[model samples]
Target chain A: MSRRVRDRKRLEGYLPPEGVPISFSIASIGARFGAQVLDIALTYGFIILLVYAMVTTGALPIEAMFALIMLCVFLIRVPYYILAELVWNGRTVGKRIVGIRVINAEGRRLTPHQIVARNLMKEVELFTPVTMVFTVDAMSGLGVLLTLVWVLAVLIVPLANRRRQRLGDMVAGTIVVDNPRNVLLPDLALSLPAQGSVPHVFDFLPAHLDIYGRFELQTLEKVLRDPVRGEEPPDFGQISRTIIRKIGYADPVRPGQERAFLNAFYRAQREHLETLRLFGNRREDKFHSAPGS
Target chain B: MTDAVAEQDKRRTGSSPDSPAAPAPQGELLRSARFRVEREGHWRRLDELVVRAEKAGPASLSYDETRELATTYRQAMNSLSVARDISLDRALLDYLETLCARAYLVVYAPQESIGGLTGRLLSIGIPQAVRRSALPLLIGFLAMVLGAVAGYVLFTGDPGWFYTFVPPDLADMRTPEASVDYLRSTIYGNDFDAAETLAAFSSYLFSHNTRIAILIFSLGIFLALPSFALTFYNGLVLGAFFGMFAVKGLGYDVFAWLSIHGVTELAAICIACAGGARLGLAVLLPGQRTRRDALREQAHDAVKLVILAALMLVAAAFIEGFLRQLVQDPKMRLAIGWGIGALWLAWLLLAGRSDEKQANEARGGSAP
Candidate 1:
């Protein structure tokens, strides 16, 4: 097979397979819900406590205290989520334990800008006039009424979203996912060695297939291989060619420069693998380790 | 023998490369191994991988594999999650929007329902109860001090200002000779006509004093400066009047005459002023709370203190209008003034003790 055919086949592999369905179990949904609540509680709880302490101690007067508390709440909220996602790569302490993470609509890890955008929009979530009413009524008989309204707003988010995103999540271009327990086998293991480096190509899979399939493949590969090995492995060009040929692409280039092609293919594969390592590998203990599972 | 049989069974299961089942080993191994596919069209392979993972022990995936798989699994999970979330968002948004609109109507619209009004009123309870009561109490105390100071100053000063404030018919009665004649007549004659005339004059005095007090209290809205001015003017007038009578050697007699009703009446007016000042302060310096919020709080406090002041004013009116006339002797008036002042002070201090007692009872009852 020619290098051209192998490259085309690699590109073709990007398309989603037919009839591969996407679904979420009730349990998974519940887990996601639990994770969301936990994240909110952990992130916001400390700020609320701090404010309460300040007010109680008379270290801050009511007006100044409230302003400071709100500012702190706003500042801490988004950064908390962003840092957790970046460090844990999408999982908060709770999310990590529950084996779920947030990602963009395309099943990719969140960009830093995206994280900031989503987290900062928490201000929008809090932008209702009711908060003002509550503050105004704080010294009146109407305080209880305002408090009730505020509580209702806070509790309503998870119940309202299918994904259980509170108002903040809606503004953030992100979604939570259950970390798949299945392993992903590296592409090198799956690709045939006769073909040169696969061309850089884009593929649009059915959304579910892209998320679930990639997760499974990566998990499987990691399970089988020792990622810490020091020596370089054999060229994957021939395997790439074979896989391409099997996938039904025709060759365009002669096979005489197999060695040179193999070298290029290996280099590309290593780079791709490194990128995946940076963005992909999730810590198991963080999320998917359910009790008694 | 068991090994031989197992080997033969493996061969029969297409372990041989020539057999169709031979493809199953590679497929099974690939399937058993965990993998994440980032590229698009890998669904068939993904399905096969899923099948393999499922068939293999669930724990076949390594820790990293599990993390990678979790992402894909979550992606699939999110499809349903997103759909569910969208519907939930619509419902919540609708509910919140309705609430927001209702709040706006209650605050901005006049044609609100009684229930809505009540709700709005009730919302003020927490803030009023917690933070507002102080304004009225503080203002009331301050006003009393100011009124007292003014009264002392005026009564101890020259009586020139007294002539301006007292009606002409009443002014003629202030002369030293007439004052002595009137005192003798009141003691000796003790006639109904004299008593009636004195009662009428006292009524006028009571009404006039209460009106001035109310005016001073209400003027706080103009700002803190006005309140002080009104307070100071009342003080100056009182001082001048007192001073004139003292110079004339009639100061002790006048003090006795005034003390009976003056204590409660003056205290009540001062309380009213305090309440008004509190309201003004709320407007001037809202602090962290909004101006509206502060104003509402102060208004509540001021209203309570005003009610209490009105009650005190009524007490003072009764003493000045009727009781003073019944007692003709200066000595009797002095005794009555002290007695009434004591009673008023007792009432003020002890009026709310019952609430504390009730609260204690409730707490005790609930303790067990």
Candidate 2:
């Protein structure tokens, strides 16, 4: 099974070194909605604070103050949303707290125009309907009906999709992903033999570690992790042989010792990179690093 | 058995001594032990640095530590790929993915400044985007005109059609049942307090029209159905009013009243609808790209158009509230309307293009 996955990876060598495609987990709708609500609350809170500051200090007349507050609710809302997303790399304070982020579905850097378009659409999606609801006397029945249709349509769109992208996300080529979490587990935990044997039994040159970098090291971590996990222990003999050849090891790997061989390589490579890293030299990739310091 | 197949079978069973299947192979175990002995330390060191960086921001690291962190990250990345090819542990693989994601965010994600963002959007971005989205814009404009023509025919042929087009509250004092004097009074407002009244009136108009245009732009996602209906209904109301005034022999009076702001207001509405239609078509047709991709591409233009239209609506509102009431003569109103309309057209179509041309020429001239 592992052999087949290896062959497939080699066939698609032009792809990124990790070989597997990275896909973001779509954020939950509840989280997304919560973030939006928080964002709106924050915006209102700021507006109230500003109004209070202005009024107490007698900075402007009451009529002008009233107009300014009204103006902020309407005109400044879109600018606020757009500016927040733009400055924070598609994160608003609300989103950051909720652990969700907006990203271009195309996997490229999001442009300013995309950000503006989506936030501007929020007027129809969220603000206008909300305004209509508040100003019931001012809005005609027809206007209210249209606002409902507009808001409902925008809301239903994301719910209808597997990706949970809102209307703005669809139009702007963006998706909200659950912000990735990194939990740092000790590196050599696996190297400690389960049977109480000494883990520090193997020894090799720094050059053995040089053959692999972070990309390969990560793949090694997965391979080592899989064996003790699932119901079926996958066959790794062909894969082990291939790695031994690739790394140019002279000794022939024993039949059952494939997993251990790979795990050892993982440990050695990780340690070598970290030690080299302690010095000034940086190895960005296989070709672009200072010669052994 | 062939050596590779034998190796493969041994691997499939169990590597441990307690395994049900055959396993006792010293050479493979020895080879594995030898490899682990050499490179384990480097991998562990990299992992420790990654842990620290992940726990705090990359900023928590010293200058030397940060440099080490980057190197460790790259090495770990390469190791992941090798491990995958070699069929190593799966836990190690998942951990590396986590590490890479953390590192990528710090290294690759760009946090832009607010001033830079505003400057880019204001400069050539909005206009150039609009110019590219010609097809949807044309469709959106035509839908509004189509509604207008239909509205005129329906309302002129049947006066009751006004009820269908204009809601009672929106129609206000401009009903056909109202006397000519009442309609005239409605347009002129209280002359005693014209300045303050007109300011309030224009603000109302601007907000009203701006909201409508914004609604049309946003609702375009429903395959542009709402946008079409909205612009069409607006046109219908206007057409019905025109038909009513014409019947009352106050056609010129109504024309003067509307002309000052109507030209810019109508054009903006039409433009906004066009933007909406682009969004709809991208969804409905999607062309060569995926539906989402097409919407995204069209949205860039549609959004720019919406922004432009909203601004025009404001200008029109100002004219309608202030200038429309002040400019009594039909000829003068028409002149002002035409001048503003032409200026907008020139700006949308030519402003950015000419600027780009000059920039290109300057670059060419500067070249050796």
Candidate 3:
């Protein structure tokens, strides 16, 4: 079941071998559409520039004219999306600006065949309907209907799933995700009897503190910040359990006091790490080295 | 030899100043804040290093800088997990998530062109796939021949069979009443408009036939019935045309006209049908695996067949438009048609085998 969840997100989560989860929020449809629009605009701009260049080279020999026309046909037919994603590490310029990236849906690296299949399918998904409209005068009624069906089939695909993946994403086994950004730590204030006033209520271990560092610290902070979604109940129990298992902590927190327990752990770990740093030693991850003399 | 720490020293100015009252001889809240503040410098420093690396490949990073980047990356990741578990600050969490995402991709995803996969596919993949589907291809070819024979026999017995099978627009000039002079001209015409008309005709055939090929391959998802019907219908049209010409005593002339491109064009159509049949069989009969697994296994070959069929149709269109026009003699057309048929057979059976051996040798050389 955990495997299914990981697969659904196209997550390359930290296994025993890999050592950490790779998580990113999937990009919503609006952002993807915006990038596509920018790409289309650029492609058209390029074609017009080529045409202008061809016209300026006046009286191009007959052979040159044929070559120019062929160039235009090639430009018109090929979408540069494949090349853009290939060269830009899964980002086109528009995608880079919008803070999204394409990745294989299976949590594997992108392959050339997948890239080609997805882009070529775009001809049927987007371009066929467009070209049909452009050549409407020549098409029979059945052809028009078929074109409409093709467009409809592709348009509804993104809406039918939580991932907001189009037919292209499904066929290519890829997903779009937000680019990573820098994390800030929130002001941590959960009202308990100030510091030592509640000393008997909980306990900590320096070794327990040693199990995590800044990376997991920020991730925990994000979870603690937003415990509830729009309608679903909060899942703090699972989150707490995962952290316990991940860090090899010996005991689970009291059932309902998951948040408070996590906060106490947070304070203990921070002080423990800061004390070490003061002694000219700074621990990083679970495998942090050498104790201060 | 090592100025990475010095480089990091110069960029340490970006950490927020107010964040640092954090020696934390005090409150739990104060400690977490100090945690954030103290670690903020590494995040900023790593981000700067990453920006440089992203701009100028990872190889450009100094040894110390690379170590710092790795150590800082792990630390940032830990901070993200901690922040999510304990903090309620949305902005901080968002920043952490984004930073982690960027860092993960830059660290893990390979940096290289994928040109080799495409090159391999074009050179060896399609032919090998075609070779594997030989039995299904033969079966599909037999089905089309059966359909053609049925259409020819039925049309010869009754002219209405031709009208029923062949669309009026396509059969416009090829009807029984078309003059011998006119029938001859379609194969060996000299008018200026003849070239233009043939060019338009070939493009129309290319799009129409290619569309059918793609549709047939995809429609195999529905137990392959539609694919069978479509292929049979295509054969029926050809048979009906031949049957009509036979009735008018122009069968030999018409055969010559068709032979030049028909062999390749028809073989392509049959391959597409076979691709669909192979898919149907996968879903209909799974020897040991689940049905879905069987379908998945067959899909690559099916896609290769679809793509190859489209390519052959394009080649056929060119042959039909230009070369067929030039070689209008009946014997020459038959020779060219049979020659192409033999070449396609030999190529499919033999071409990619050599490449397969070469690739295996290359892999062997690298393995040890």
Residue B107 CA error for candidate 1 (Å)? 18
Report lDDT (CA) for all predictions.
0.45, 0.67, 0.66
- Across B143-245, the per-residue lDDT of candidate 1 in tens digits comes to 5456546655555453444665445564445543356556434333444444445444555555555545545554454454456566655555455545556
Worst 10 residues of 2 chain B by lDDT: B1-10
Query: Interface RMSD (C-alpha) of each candidate?
Result: 24.0, 10.6, 10.7
What TM-scores result for chain A when each predicted structure is judged separately against the true chain A?
0.37, 0.55, 0.55
- Tell me each candidate's TM-score: 0.32, 0.64, 0.64
lDDT of 2 by residue, B1-368 (tens): 01221232222211232221223244434222323334446556765665565345455679998787667656656654444333233354555555555445444443445677556655675667667768767776777677777877887799889888888888877888888888777665546244656666676677767878888888788788889888888877888878787787777777777778888999889888888888888899987779877888788778888888888998998888678778777788778988898887776676567577775699699966
Ranking by lDDT: 2, 3, 1
The residue-level lDDT of candidate 3 at A175 comes to 74
Worst 10 residues of 1 chain B by lDDT: B8-17
Instruction: Please give, for residues B166-278, the per-residue lDDT of candidate 3 as tens digits.
Output: 89998877676677777777757754235655565566567667766766665565466767877888889888888877777778877877878999898888888887777
* Root mean square deviation (Cα) for candidate 3: 11.2
Docking class of 3: incorrect
What's the TM for chain B in candidate 3? 0.75
Q: Write the number of the candidate with greater TM-score, choosing between 1 and 2.
A: 2
Query: lDDT of model 2 at residue B268?
Result: 89
